[model samples]
Target: MKISTFISTLALTLLMLIPFNSNAQEFPDLDKSPMDAAAFPSKYDEPKKLIKIIYSRPQLKGRSIWDLAPVGKVWRTGANEAAELTIYTPMLFGDTKIEPGTYTFFMIPGKQEWTAIISKDLNVWGSYFYNEENDVAKVAVPVKNDKNNSIEAFSIVFQETSKGTDMYLGWGHIRLAIPFHKL
Candidate 1:
């Protein structure tokens, strides 16, 4: 009986060791444009989150900013999908009050200024389907050049200021800050 039981155990172990032709999930390689998120009160221990944004970072692989995002055209604000912005509290976007909610972020790039639009649309792939009717808030922010701080990857960061918070977008040598004043 003991010899038979040992043989059975050995056989089970060998079977487990043998690789089978099962349908294993194959995860693809890393994304060329990786998804990222930024939030106000950036610390993890912060109890309240004022605002947050989910976007993709597209690198400038020997491509100019105009190549990826054309001038005087609506951009999804990122690479893969339209940037998603969640406002936790009512905030004033250049006198236009924006309520606490999630919205799609889009931008129409220009040489002097950029029109930042907050739309009611959500889960959109790109600005290809952008509709003007869905825009809830639109603000024209002047483009600032920071030749010293040339950023290769598209990035959005929130910085606390005396007025309120500034959501700054940097790429190449261009920088734009969208102010969110406290209500």
Candidate 2:
């Protein structure tokens, strides 16, 4: 009776260990999912210019406006919710002045010059049905490549400077820089 009880206990322990051991294995197929925009923390406060750009993934895959995007094409830029971009203070991009307000961000990716359009419309999806006539400001910015690329997800980073701020968009091997001065 003692030997039989010991065998039963050992069998129960092995049954429990099987599920735990299989859980340790990694599944690459499970890694595909839409990234949460809230994962990127916001740094907004008074006095300083606060620009918050919110993006989402409506589809299974992600959206891109590059070689994935075509030249002379209008991209929704982001998923649902119009890819909202809120500016706290007045800012100047080239000669164009962007007031402190929320606006929908759209992009026209090209081989030579990528056009960044700030539209009065703040709510939209993919730019499949974007109206260029509603653009508040359109600025042409050059795209450059970085040697040491590490950023995997699409991101926008702001670097404060003495004059103003430098907004950078990093994705894959491309890094585009845009300077803005306070108005």
**Candidate 1, which segments miss by more than 4 Å at Cα?**
1-23, 43-46
The global C-alpha lDDT for each of the candidates, from Candidate 1 onward, is 0.92, 0.67
- Candidate 1 per-residue C-alpha lDDT over 1-183 given as tens digits, one digit per residue, 9 for 90 to 100: 699999999999999999996768788999999999998978363568888899999999889999899999999999999999999889998778999999999999999999999999999998999999999989999999997889989999999988779999999999999998887
- Supply every candidate's count of residue pairs whose N, Cα or C atoms clash at under 3 angstroms: 0, 2
Residue 106 displacement (Å), model 2: 1.0
Tell me the TM-score of model 2: 0.68
- Per lDDT, the best of the predicted structures is 1
TM-score of 1: 0.87
**Whole-model alpha-carbon lDDT for candidate 1:** 0.92
